[model samples]
Target: MSDWEEDWDNGDSKATSKPYNKRNNAKDNSISNRSDESGRHRSSENRAPIRYPQAGEKRSNGQRHKHSEKIEVPSDLVGMLIGRGGANIQRIQNDYNVRVDLDKESGTATINGNTEQNVKDAYNDIEHHLNNGPGSRYNSKDGSSGHQSNAIYNFQLKGRNNKPGDTDDIEMDPSGVIDWEALNKKAKKERAARWSKLPELRKDFYNEDPEVANLTPREVARLREENNNITVSRVFQQENVSENIPNPVWKFEQCFSAYPDLLEEIYKQDFRKPSPIQSQAWPILLKGEDMIGIAQTGTGKTLAFLLPAMIHTEYQLTPRSQRKGPNVLVLAPTRELALQIEKEVNKYSFRGMKAVCVYGGGNRREQISVVKGGVEIIICTPGRLNDLIEAEVIDVTSITYLILDEADRMLDMGFEPQIRKVLLDIRPDRQTVMTSATWPPGVRRLAQSYMSNPIQVCVGSLDLAATHTVKQVIEIMDDGDKFYKIREFVRNMGKDDKAIVFCGKKTRADDLSSDLTLEGYMCACIHGSREQSDREQAIADITSGHIKLLIATDVASRGLDIEDITHVINFDFPRNIEEYVHRVGRTGRAGRSGTSISFITREDWGVAKELISILEEADQEVPIDLRNMAERFKSMKDRRANESSKFNDRDGNSGSRGYRGGGGAGGRGRRDRY
Candidate 1:
């Protein structure tokens, strides 16, 4: 015999001397067939002795010899192979008559059997257990067990030529026939399983108020109708909801009766009824449940959260002397928003309920003194709050109510880390309320991580599109024509009609404001580069009607609630839809109609589609050129995305290899470190 045959014969003598177990032959034929189909047989000169059963293997009743092998198990599959109480592993050991050892930390499995086939069988069985376990099924087309035919068939089905009644046959390889029925059934099953996990309402257990729990379905429906069909949806909730949770009430009197002092204050402010957000949010928040309120700007969202927080604080009855610091904390994104919230707090600060607003660019010593003096509520920006916390001047442990107003804007302004730091100092069990004009992904992530089974209340569509209260007029023109067009629009407005001219940059706002002032238009500018005092003064001038026209950037886009502003002029269209929404929202406040005129240039083409959609949603007449530009922009975006994806795929493939062409060890040599 040749040397290779001699080696195979020598190895088989040891395997043949051992007794073969009958269970090892269960899948022997299938394995042999697969090996033959895959051309797994090596040349006779270099072949290793086969360990598994051959095409016609018989049981041997001779003395057995031990055989061993090691297999690596995926970390995620380790729990499944071990099973509960080691039941699956024990069963495998008993049935296979082999010893199996598993290293949990390293995720390695060692199998030992009296015969070679036994060890192979035990290893295969362990793999089978893992494959059938949870999260084992590969979903991507390139996955090990994923069927390329199924993916191709699905792609073909979605192709344009494969419509109903079309007799065009999908070409298939004869050697690899597609299983159409099986693929269809599997696709349907996966789709159904995915849809089964769609979001659904669950009972809320956070609020245990007996009054709120006693609410009936009939009463809830009546309240909803009275409040113009306000809806409350839950993204996530717990079971064991209190049966005493109160139903939503429409009017402020119906809800605020429990707080006579607050009710008197509301009456003093001439507020007859609650806004939609306030009406829906009061019941949930008053009952001590976390909430996310999404409403348009100037829709009374401040009062919606503040009122509940105040009522809850009153219920706690914590003495002013004993209170370590502010019992309620309201975090705003900007000094402007912080000041605005403080102004509203002052309106409702009846019967010794005091509030202090802290923000950056103000006197730190003054803010420290106010906070040290003890207040029931603290309204501040994130940066200033963090500064106070680090300085050990503010103790947030006593804070029970945490409110994040204009939350989406806060995240956009990159205040997430500061917000998180401030939250870390507060108690986790505090009732958290997040209010935003829009719900972006970042805002959603913050809500999910911080809030406890919060109820979401949306006043209108959550898209944050421009409200119908403002009429949008798109003026398509060249960059050179923008100034003249804005000037003409401003001149046409009545002298009493106040207008805000929005620019793309602070310098642009400054230059435009100067030009407008020189042209004899009463205009003043406010932007981030301006001092806080100057911004405040400019806002005051605009609010007091001393300045009929104001020029600014997106810094003034949020939480500047001036009444009857009449006009908002976009000298430069916003690059994003959210900024556009807030810019226009500056006007159309407190039941007053306003006009927004946007001067769109070539630079603003990217946002044309979204802007057009907002205009269409508001029922405004879209300009024909704007519609065409939006379509062209959409096509360009799609083309660019496709090109980018293709380029990435090419680079990824090239990166997998050591190098395409190189002389220095296949580009694997290390470079000198600096």
Candidate 2:
């Protein structure tokens, strides 16, 4: 199970049950002042991929908010299909890899999956079974599924007391602007493309010289090794990269000679040359090509897209006043990221073009007022932006440059609904660029669905590879010894050295901060449970050197860009391998060398194999015991799978699917699966 241990909100990341404030309700008095996090005021929601609450809801403990689709069955056939002792339901859960909350009294079974596709598949299968069950009235004589009525009732639960599909405080748009019909229509169109779906991972694309059509993860990693961050053609192309793709610009003048204003901004920052990603990304983005930028954090991804967005906005034939919405739209996964992008946009004045970051937690009216007044660029989190769109305060019809920054992270936080909702209204022909550290299936699926023929630009390896600049150290120890291990490591740091301690849980971070503080360490902590303002202060302390240590969860892993961070201590190995890469990335940033210390334990055996692989990829030394643990875990898993296969064979059931309830449950799972 993931951090939430609950199914994702059908992969939409909407508030399944717990809603924040009503749309356009009076300003939330509790929230005051302008916040940089264009995301909602997350109450420590942690890394729950199921539900991302809006402004008013509380998720301090980072619990899962159950959003479900309930199907009403005839009371007579319910028991028959359910099977005795709920055996049939358990089989469905294991077979389809979904969750079913049986409401025997109501004769309704609630179905949910970690992703949208999974939920839809499970729902369809259940409906089929119900129709074919013993004495099912819907069953046809030809062994075909009979005409099924509307048995599924979908609802977004509200409040703590409400159950799945609860119908309280549900709001509807009378103007037909935010209706489901139009959104579904738009979604149906996005799926028409051949590459819109995630490719099955069974094929091997890792030969010495792989075929051009096979763009597998291993092949991408191999290309990263061969290219060594240099721009190359065809070897890494996804077949869609056209013959005349623009060449990378090494010198600043070579790319920006047309825009002296932009050149001046580059000089102001004292930037000498284009970074690896920026070198290649500029020409493609400036050419209005849809792109997927696979680069690490702090590699200047913002300017790669932002500069082009400005150029695109200025060249637009439509007048600013006549345009319904801003010509450029930037969707960030978190409030911090949205705010960061807006700040970058501010650094360089682009024809006096205005930009606003709208996220959760901030005063909505202030953001809306900024957009309504007039703006050429809009930087916002998905929820807040969606709210503004539904309220009709902002229009996306005129948007020509759309950016999904940290696109993979947005999906991990379950912001797909907000992203998809906003994209539905935008023109399909817009130039879209999605930047991500990892190219997971979810992000790829999103690109295929929304983007035109996209050119993939990967600076580093795509196989969950670690930053080569960072020195990775792995320690095998008991949980009791971890505190002392980190303490000793911190004690040896230089005066100017700064470090971030990452813990898995919010309470663990708070507890560790307390422990470290009592031991006379200058430290602060931030996690999903922390308030937006507190998170700001924690980041501020580390950046200003006011505190030597900043304890954090994955919240600070991606967006926080403090250049002087000297070390990263994985007080707890991250929940997954991709997160581990992101956590370590916080330290080794912007060409700066850094060190990362990770402590492993027996219980974390499942992660051992990938950990070793990441270590090897970075040329970091791996302990012998860690490799042993990985082998043992792999053997144990295979053994269990073999036993289960035999059992399934005896029972005459299909159970060959791998990794149940893990990554296999959702197509969006990290491709770093061992």
Candidate 3:
């Protein structure tokens, strides 16, 4: 692991497992298999008797339990056949009241149950999953998965051409393998049996929130000012939720009941007090109410929801080992953010809790191994998470706490569909907390669609705004003048200063990093085109102060935290104002002062109006030339709006209008985070 990955560690949490080995992870970055049906990872310890049959367990007559013939599971298919953390196998055992175990060396499985029918059903279930491995892409009738060929049991591929350079060894065969309807019936039975054990929803856990009554409008106004313009209102209705709101926690001791581990994390991280968002969010969230936290970038949003999740997951009635799947699911927009959240989760020593970060570019097998090791929280990006869901590596149905960090960014990255798909499987009553810097229409639509009576806690104005601590400096110049302007700023840099330069394109970032290096200025660069590990290294280099300068595109704009970063230089302004806010907000983090320099050329005039608005909102100096450019763009926009019918963009994402429109690329307002 790079130092960047471990930089935040204070060794406060009892880490459940070590990071996955990277030796063979190169080949397996994504799960090739996907299906709507999924199962959960579980351990044998403390599992209900309905799941695993004990040794010598038999019918009332005291006869020996019937054992199914050993199934020869291919060595490679064992993981899926048994499911990650033995979830699939455990599902089968619970459904049929059977005992199933895998022999890794022998590559075989045995199923023992009270009746022959139970053993046979369990065997068929494993066979079905084994059959539906990555190689089998096509489904049979009713969109149901097909089983593998009988020859695969012996590690032999049937109908192999053995042609040179042919890598595909497994093939799909949909020919009737088992009674699909009968298996469905067994699955339904198992689901019902398991859900019956779910603990009742309760807000009055040992750790309690300050139960306060309704606040007068005047009191609310006063409270908002005190909490940095934070506003809390119920958005929907839930049976268990209270109309009476809870007061925000000013101190860590006031929020948690008796969690010493969490306090230890707070102390280790040197968090003197809760940020505005955390202060209010912690109270509402700890009260078990769905919440939407709107806060500025780098205002301690991660810990706001994370700390509450620790309390909820650990204090639940079910033990971590006995749970069917993860208790919490945090949907992040990017892998960097996902890994960052995982790091935050790792910093606390809270009840031996574990969390895993799964994304598209990381090793799928290694992720599966870590998840199997047992994790209560699974923090992941949408795409890879959906893939894992399809492969049954994760089961969201058991998840009770759900968080959508940067809900706007997730939708902007075109992850709405995936987010919705993931949400469909999760329980409706799960405590959901969504945090976004701005309250956009799309985010509102999503919250309305899924969340229970959510208490929306807005830390600042809901409008799109940059970090107020950063001093914004805008220079309107020719495109060619940008290079020299950035050079002058870099030359005047303080030794302790760290800066992140933003470019519009990946190639531009690479070129900038190279030209600067040749000019005797060493720097790291990152964008979407680089390998996952390489991108991580670049971030690590800058984060660990191994390098004082870094260049990147919009990829680094969201959910990246380097508190000491002194400057943000917009070498090439982003296409949209939303991205520009994210870029400049990268600096001036964690209550620190910073500076942002943007060289805005005529070509970048489209976003000028919105740029001026952001600058004015942050009380930063806006150059006269920049103001003139915004007016010019506004006139140009009015002219274009009147010129042609085709000029009317449905989302108006061409420039400053994009911010007002509050959408992306005529799709999910998502262009690309990378």
TM-score of each: 0.64, 0.67, 0.68
Q: Model 2: per-residue lDDT, tens digit, 1-674?
A: 23221212211132222333345321222211211124233331232122222324433654342445779777777655455444455445544446665565666777766666556656776776675555566443444332221122122332222232332323324321223454456446655552233221111111121233345656544544554464334323456546555555556776677788878888999887888887777777776667888888878899888887887777566555666668889998776677778888999986888999887666767888888899998988776666566556777876778999999988887778768877877766677889999888889889888987778888866767888889999889867778888888878889989999988777788888888889988799987656667877888888899998999877777778788899998887887898898888888787789999888866677788889999998899999999998887778778878978897989899666565322222333332111
Better of 2 and 3 by TM-score: 3
lDDT of 1: 0.70
Q: Highest lDDT among the candidates is held by which one?
A: 3
RMSD of 1: 22.6
lDDT of 2: 0.68
Q: Which stretches of candidate 1 lie over 4 Å from their true place?
A: 1-219, 222-229, 239-245, 638-674
Question: Which candidate leads in TM-score?
Answer: 3
Candidate 1 per-residue lDDT, tens place, 44-122, comes to 2342222322324332536354898878888887756655444456546544557666665566787878878767777
Candidate 3 TM-score, C-alpha based? 0.68
Arrange candidates, best TM-score first.
3, 2, 1
- Reference-based lDDT, residue 104, model 2: 55
Model 2: residues >4 Å from true position, as ranges? 1-227, 230-242, 642-674
lDDT of 2 at 209: 17
| Tens digits of lDDT, candidate 3, 1-674 | 21122211211011112233345211121223312123343332234322222234333535456566578887777766645444456446555666675666676777767777667766665665665564554334444434433223223322222221221333333453444345457556756776676666544443443443345557656866787878777866566866766766667887764777678778898878888888778878887878888888898999999988988988777666777788999998777788889988888888888889887667768999998788899998777777677667787888999999999988776668778888878876688889898888999999999987778888778788988888998887766667677777788889899999998777778877887888889899987667789989998999999999999878789878989999999987887888888888899998899999887766676677788889888888888887887777677656656644344455454433332322212433322222
Which parts of model 3 have CA positions greater than 4 angstroms off? 1-31, 34-221, 237-242, 640-674
